[model samples]
Target chain A: MKDKTSKNQVLLKRQDFLKGMVAAPLVIAGLPNSAGAKPSASDAGNNVSYLFDSTKCIGCRSCTSACNQINDAELFSHDRPLDLSERSRTAIRVFLDDTKDKGTFIKRQCMHCLHPACVSACPVKAMRIDEKTGIVYNDPSVCIGCRYCMVACPFDIIQFEWDKKFPKIIKCTMCKETNLKTRGITACVDVCPSGALIFGTRKKLLAEAKKRIKKNPKKYVPKVYGEKDGGGTNILYIAGKDFDELGFPKNLGDESPAVITESIQAIYSWFIAPVVAFFLLFIPVSKNFKKVAGEENEG
Target chain B: MKKSEGSLAQQPLFGKIALAFVLLGLIIFLIRFFIGLGPTTNMSAGFPWGIWIAIDVVVGTAIGTGGFLMAILIYVFNKGSYHPLIRSAVMTSAFGYSIAGLSVIIDLGRWWNFYTLLLPWRWNTHSVLFEVAICILAYTIVLWLEFTPVLHEKGEDSGIMKIGFIKSIVNKLNEKKDGANKLLIVVITLGILLPIMHQSSLGTMMAIAKTKLHPLWHTPFLPILFLISIGFMGYSVVAIEALYSSFYLKRKYEVTMLRNLAPLTAALAVIWIAIRFFSLLSEGKAGLMSSSGTLSTYFWLEIIAVIIGTILMIAVKFSSSPRFIFISALFLIFGASLYRINVYIIGYNPGSNYNYVPSVMETMGTFALISAEFLLYLLFLRVLPILPAEHK
Candidate 1:
């Protein structure tokens, strides 16, 4: 009787093992496509771009004051006018070479990358790029203030409202909901005296940047700052000095950080790996189950 | 299994310390809510994530991985003899995850808007954090359900029903015990699946910070590394908890089962170290180890801790001794936690200008959170059938 029962237990275990193997693949098939289903390319065409020429900038803090006034933001606790914070939407940082004679003023704000890492990092669609205008915006209503966007952003543009009871992410939106909506131009671009800042379609900005570089190769850095940096940014810069010397991130490849991780996720979420893992794990489970059953029958 | 595990001990000293910590933490939390994150935390724009994320959520959840590890061993691997360890591990995991969830709420700048995380329509499919959040939420619920059987078992065996209200609830729970047990198969499977997804997703969360994170700790293989380390930490936590319980509660030590687990723990630790070094070499980042910096120091410390812990785990003499096992478990937990801290904090360099250190209140808050977890754990162990019944 014991031998027959043990034989039946072994058969039951094999059947259970087979059932687990079959179930794993079926479960995998039901999972949503691992590749992000969003349309990636459509938003680029409509994106408004900025052209900031450091050669034309005169170290005047007018644009900084203009941005602060327009945004109705506060001064940073440290009271540094050049630093970007929740209270300061934009800043013009003055960089001097070792000689201290050559000073370059660079305007810094949100790059508004075409493939924004902040948008990809936000778990709740609080950070999003507007499909129509291609402006990156943060919705405080839905934001949990996880600060994941701040970490994901290579440019370090997103500032937090650390002092506020109900904090929100503060980043340049190209005056999408503010000055641009009513005045047809960003506050800083509209207020620049030296024509250093220009607001237009990304195509026009790129052409303008290229024309400047081609016309005066010696005067410009020979490359548009955001054209291919971090998978192309809406905000472009034509700096007289090397970007790395002026506090810009160095060695940033053209690929967005989001693409790197998302692709890995896609490969793993393809279902085959997980199914194989389940099958591998099931073997021990089946053997142990049979042994226990056989032992029970003997007892 | 249905019998009482043991009588509750008069743990006055522990109870007092836990209450004091909880009270202090509550006071700090009130200050934090009123004053905002800036005053209470060392978080800046450059250093947005602090210990709240690194210790509470990341390390806390890693420690909580005990339940899933045991589930994999018992349900997926079908090692039924390990069943005695499952309930206690599950309880610990449930508490760990619950504290992590609460820490997230406390850490969020806009805590009121936290419900947006639950709205499926707002979910970002591309975000790894989204997967983590959803999985954690689901797993916490599943863990609680898995724990109900313990409560039911306790209610059925313990006859001291002094309070009418309490007695009625126990009766209801006891009445549903059979149905709940039947449903446990599905719950256990889910409990196994959810942790695999989230624990790795936690690592993926750090992967997005490519340039900011130091090369020593940052790799594209972060998800895999995290999963393996978490598995090692999970077994270590189980070992520590088992040994501690046996010593303090005066119960029989499951030394033989724990001794059997030593090889598996050591093997996982070995695999983790191999993968970590191999991935670092493959990324051409092995040169960074010699850099004279805080990050390099922490990185070497993490590596040393793991090596020593693994060596101890595999050594026959050390693995056999309860004291050595406990010490090794501590080292493994420390190594795993430091790895997470290095990944999230030490290795992260937003810029030369930004610096952060946890404030006094932030430290107190973390302490309180841990103390509360211990208090709850003690309460559950006393009242629930979490431990195996002592043979009279």
Candidate 2:
């Protein structure tokens, strides 16, 4: 009786392969959910930051042109890229309300969030954050050109090199590889003669923005922008006008979309949830397919 | 073991017109390779992704869920009487997914580095698109494998396998067919598993967009909503395909089977409508459904169309005629496609001086991708034993 039962088990081994294949991914896939992509106070590494004061911006756009020259020294074109384009990395746009008052000129570039939506959105890690510098950057070589990063960025700074055959994402990289490396300052910061754009560690720049706002409450908005905006951007802004009047989104909450998106995505990354889901799906599908196959054999 | 005597191209006027559109699409598709996306498409920095992504990759794949949807119905739900419908449903998915995969390369700026997607170390699993890309790729391959029995059946008797070495492989494939089917039983489950991952991730892609997406459409439940929406969209296409095949190919309709499916899909659509409404109300954007300008117009239109389709789908269960099924399928397809287009395009305001409307060439590119799907479907129907054998 024992020999016959062992033979029966041996014969049933073929069915076991199917079950094993279905079960193996569950075993191989996941560990328990760990500490996820929650944001901490000092998450944006070392936090090199840029501070811009709109009150001092003369609307001359010299810094914009300087940004064009220093980032891609080979490109000769320096006409203001009406809206930032592949050729133009940083842009100074003049925003006017419905009243169309003598509009305020605000410069726009990558905000380089502490928890970047682009970093979270890039499928290939083409966009990433530098741990030492806390600067968000893009690696064109790894980008599969899915454009998910472009869709995710709340700042609307990221653009595509749509016209080129060998195109890359066209956005500000905070001059991490260029002027920031050799000269230790961005081209825009170096060119801002009026002291509108300044660079320092994030903690220093943020404190400086608050001091300026505190000293002359009538001259500046009381709030230091990016203190809690877009999951606390590395860029700080203190403007004469309200962010809403200045054509900035009024409610760029302290929380990043990255954190929100990541919390939801943690299940897949944790591995076990999808593995369990696969096993649950497998049971019914296998049982039903067998039932149908048996009937097909009969009919 | 039987086949249709005539292919789609054999139809008198309709066949010629389809072939012409497909040829036109092919020519335009090739033209894009030389000229680049900027000159050929109306996409800009303000609007990086346009119709190709919004329509073809996102919504097209939603339509492609027909196979997985049917897999759930026949296998998971144990509604095995719908078994005759399975091969054709899988064929629809096979064509839809394979074509969507092919056309996405045209949209990618760096098409040569497309191979980087396969490199494991490069993957950013935190990204919803990463999950979507991996799942779609796995599902597309699995979908084709699921159709292998159909291919084997056709190839065994067809002219091509008569070649010497090919014939030996075909015989080997034939001999292992039963074993393959058992394995495919596992695979079909995988096919079911993958779509749930990717289809929901498609919505998660937008969820990360935050304030860029209009408040009316944005919600934490987007993934669940998208997961449910595909059931109705997939079922609608399955219904449409059933009626179209019966009408055009001189085959009988799976009337009772399709009637059974309508209630399941309608139930899904009902859940879809309720969740969308409550998601709006909870998000406190429900009032914007009327007060907001053109955005509200599109939202109301999408909801009303789905509501009408849902009611008609419920009515489809009470009747035998295929007309209501076809009309309701059209409405549901329109409604679901409109919802996606609304989320991806109309409502995606990244708040800069940026705007987008698809260029003539961009629209043509979309038409070409769609025509390729049609051409493939017709060609497959001609070559493979996809439609059911006659009962008599």
Candidate 3:
């Protein structure tokens, strides 16, 4: 937006010349490149894999209990969690399928996406994606409690401590520190006797998910979970019924949130280039400005 | 400041009234410290930010862009004609920023540790807030230093020529004043660079939360939108301040320069609308813009205000009408302000679960910050030759 002080006046010759020289290329660079646009969901190896096959599971809340115990989360009164809450890091929400006439439990936690928006959105690198494990982590000590990460998370997995005078952001770390590292299994994965939840590398899990769908197309939902949802999550799921019936958000592509912001920010950063171009054009504009000023003085 | 001009220190009625309101606000602000954000503000977990963050800091910084815009025009661009406006604009920018700095203290739950941003080793490069904090701090210092010439002029005019204790201190500081002022151009450059970096980063701060913000506002272009609007707001503030001063002092308006300034304002407004238009269409949220009930109303209001402002400005371009110009410029400011508030809070939707409406104290705190700014502006212009000399 240009400043509004000079409404009716013509652009000073020098101003016009300088503006044209600097602004023309900016407009050119700002043009959208439709040809080079890529699919939103390709994983750059940032994902934490989880497998949940409803057919193999029972309706036990042991996973939820174990998660709470390991994380020292708030204790819910009821044995079963029908909803996802701030304090509850992970929960199994049940979905009743009308067409298939079956009950499936969907475990919800951080998707740990390949292009995690929280990590990208964090201005101070407070949220980081561990290269080795693909775990999305937040350093509380560095967090200013801005809560922008909470808004960026598509799954609404992140929460803030609003009541605290100085609060820390809270989210699931995938129990990687305890279960996967030392115990060789996650709290939820270890405790699930029904083989409902399986944990492994995203690549291995994705292949296994595809294999299950291929072996029995009728039994599975034909689509492998996390294959391309919001740029693909590390967690994969194979349900006996349709995924949407089990409360999965449908139509989420593998597109990373960071891409959109980067494109715009990239355009603004192009300010330096246009400015340099203006400098290149400066000699002519400066000459024109002096000439105009001299003419005005003569008149 | 000269003996011939007599004492300009006499307070105007408006200044006294403005000071009273400022004191009231300060008292209310004191109450906020004793209590907490919870007792004072409408902020919630769902909406962690409120008007203070959006209006007092974000919009305030943009409105303060006058100094930067003028600096670029005069110093960098070497359009020396614009230099006369720089001092007054810089004074306004200083007050705007200082108030914003105070608001930051109010906004922070753990403000004592704000100095943590200054720690070299503790730097968090990934944190946008950290960047904003450091830049604002440095810029405030720059603003005061830039206005040192006004302080020297004040001392000289007061007839403290003898090198007494305080006179000697002032003289020592003012020694080789031209060299000192020339050496400080680096600070001026930072003043221009820092606002650009931090103000845009303010918008980038929101870009991180893609899902939380309404689709109407949730674009990668948020930073650009913020930057442009600030550019527009900067001029609007200058226009407002100049006009108000002219009216109060009963001096002839700098009509020619102001007329030129109007077109720039219009251009920025048009640019902002264009980007918003494309961003919405490309993002595939145009339908939601019109269909979303409450959000749609706010969206329309923003659009209508901008359009009216644009038309008014264009009309003024063809022919000048003071009333129309004032009305249109006012509309432009209203539209820009609403758009900013909308992007930060109104357009945001956490979930259907929670709601936020600012409490009285929160509103009072914001008012208090503004009052302080107005009060300081009044005091500075009186004591310092910050305002340009009225044309004979």
Candidate 4:
């Protein structure tokens, strides 16, 4: 009886292994065409962009105050004009230079990368980049206030309202809201006496940025900030000194961080495949136990 | 010895208290909806993720490692004798993950938009949390589906007396037990697959925080380390749950099954320690321990916990006492939780200027969550046929 049972178990094992081998490819083939099911590209808005030249910025808090007024937001501190507080969407950060050049001002806000980590990190379709202008914007209604976007931004440009009863994220939308809703241009650009912050298309700013660098090769650093950094951000920066001296993160690559991790995670998450594979493998592997249970039931 | 006829109607004292506690926690959670996380939590710009992300969701899901342990037994090891424990372990997993889901809803600032996470358009397949969320959600459904037969069996016998209308349907379904058992094999197999994917994805979440997380915990081998630790912790949770159930229910201990569990737990611990050292050496982060002034303390603390935890389990090879096994399992549990706490809280640093301390209320809320889970587990085992009948 034992020998006969052992033979039946061997047959069962062989059948299962064969079945699993046949089923494996079919399972992979049946997987939803993940690429085809991607989100619609129709939400792209106009390609409005920002050109920030650090040498021209006077560090005068005029742009910061203008952004607050344009956005109709409150100030964190009324004692002095706030510099990029939770309420202030954008401002100039001072990077004191001790070399031949005097101190320079660096504008701080979202880079609006061609491929953004914040948009990818938002569990909801809350954060998205406009296809037309490539402006990264957040829909507050859809935002769960997870602040994952803050962690994911390499530039550290995104700020949150920590003190508010119902806090929302604060970021430089390139005055897209004001420009799109009302015919008024970006408040920061409108108030800039030195023309430090310019509002235009990214293509125009890139051309303008290149012209300035070519005219005075000795005046600016060899690198163009946001040109190809983290997959080409819309907010371009031209500086007179080394980028890091002006508080920029050094050594960030052009490749989007989200792109690298997605393929690896997606493969393993297909739930139906592995579970089916396991059972096909197990039914034969546990034949001895099954036979024993079957015989015991008969007894 | 006295034997009592098992009826689903008899409610234990623990059951009533558990229900009351869940009710109270729900009320507090409702209040959290009107107000924001700022009022209820000590969350700041410096510390955006606090106890909710770390202890309640991360640690809570890890504690549900029992199902994984059972899966390894019944499927991988081909230990069919351990079948009875599968349903109960799965039920625990179901409840544990479902509560993690609930904690997530409570934690979100914009809870209304949570459906976006489920929307097909919003799936960020590359994201670790996305993978974790999808897997955990699917696993919760799979777990309850797998445990339904246990309910149907009990309902067939006494569901009429406890709840009248449900019995007739259960009586009809009981006759189809053979077909259902075949379906159960697929469900149980999913129980095994979901954890392996999601638990590793959980580790992948911290791996992406390479810039923010401390160097000691942040290594490329982080996912592998997380996988090993979760498997070890899962076995430990199974041991802890079984031991607790044995004590409270006054039933004969399943020493034979529990004995086999130690070797697997020990093996995973050894693997966990090996990778921890290898990754640190290769990454050249060995020097960070001495260089870091304050974080150095936590580095040593994590190292000691893993080392001492593995050593305790090793000692049990010579000593056969259940107490030693329990203590060793506790060490493993402590080690795993510390690893999570260290990665999420102690090691994470956004910048130098800001400081944050978790408010007392945040800690209390975490305590309430844990208390509530334990209370339900007690209530569930008594009311539902969660525990197996004592062997005659």
Among these predicted structures, which one has the highest TM-score?
A: 2
TM-score of 3: 0.78
Residue-pair clashes per candidate: 0, 0, 31, 4
TM-score of model 2's chain A: 0.84
The reply for model 1, stretches above 4 Å from the true place, is A1-43, A73-80, A267-299, B1-11, B156-179, B316-319
| Interface alpha-carbon RMSD, every candidate | 3.5, 2.4, 5.5, 4.4
Say which prediction, candidate 2 or candidate 4, comes out ahead on TM-score: 2
Sort every candidate by TM-score, greatest first: 2, 1, 4, 3
Looking at model 1, the pairs that clash are none
Q: Write the per-residue lDDT of candidate 4 for residues B266-329, one digit (tens) a residue.
A: 8898898888888888878889878887788887777677677678877777776767778888
Q: Output the better candidate (3/4) by lDDT.
A: 4
lDDT of 2 at B295: 93
Which tens-of-lDDT digit does each residue in A1-299 have in candidate 2? 34543464455443333433443343223221211343354544247888999988988888888888888777746687666777888888787756877667788888888778899888888898876666788888888887888888888778887877678887787888898998998889988988999999888887789899889999997888777887788888998888877656645687787765665676664466678877898888888888998888798
Q: Global lDDT of each model?
A: 0.80, 0.80, 0.68, 0.69
Worst 10 residues of 4 chain B by lDDT: B1-10
Which DockQ values do the candidates obtain, in the order shown?
0.36, 0.44, 0.14, 0.21
Per-residue lDDT tens digits of candidate 1, residues A35-142?
Answer: 332333333545677799999998776777777777764442323376787788788888998999889998889998877888989999999987656688899989
Task: Give me the runs in candidate 2 sitting further than 4 Å from their true place.
Answer: A1-35, A43-45, A96-101, B1-10, B160-170
Instruction: Name the lDDT of candidate 2.
Output: 0.80
Candidate 4 residue pairs in clash (backbone atoms < 3 Å): A44-A131, A46-A133, A47-A133, A262-B126
Among incorrect, acceptable, medium and high, the docking class of model 1 is acceptable
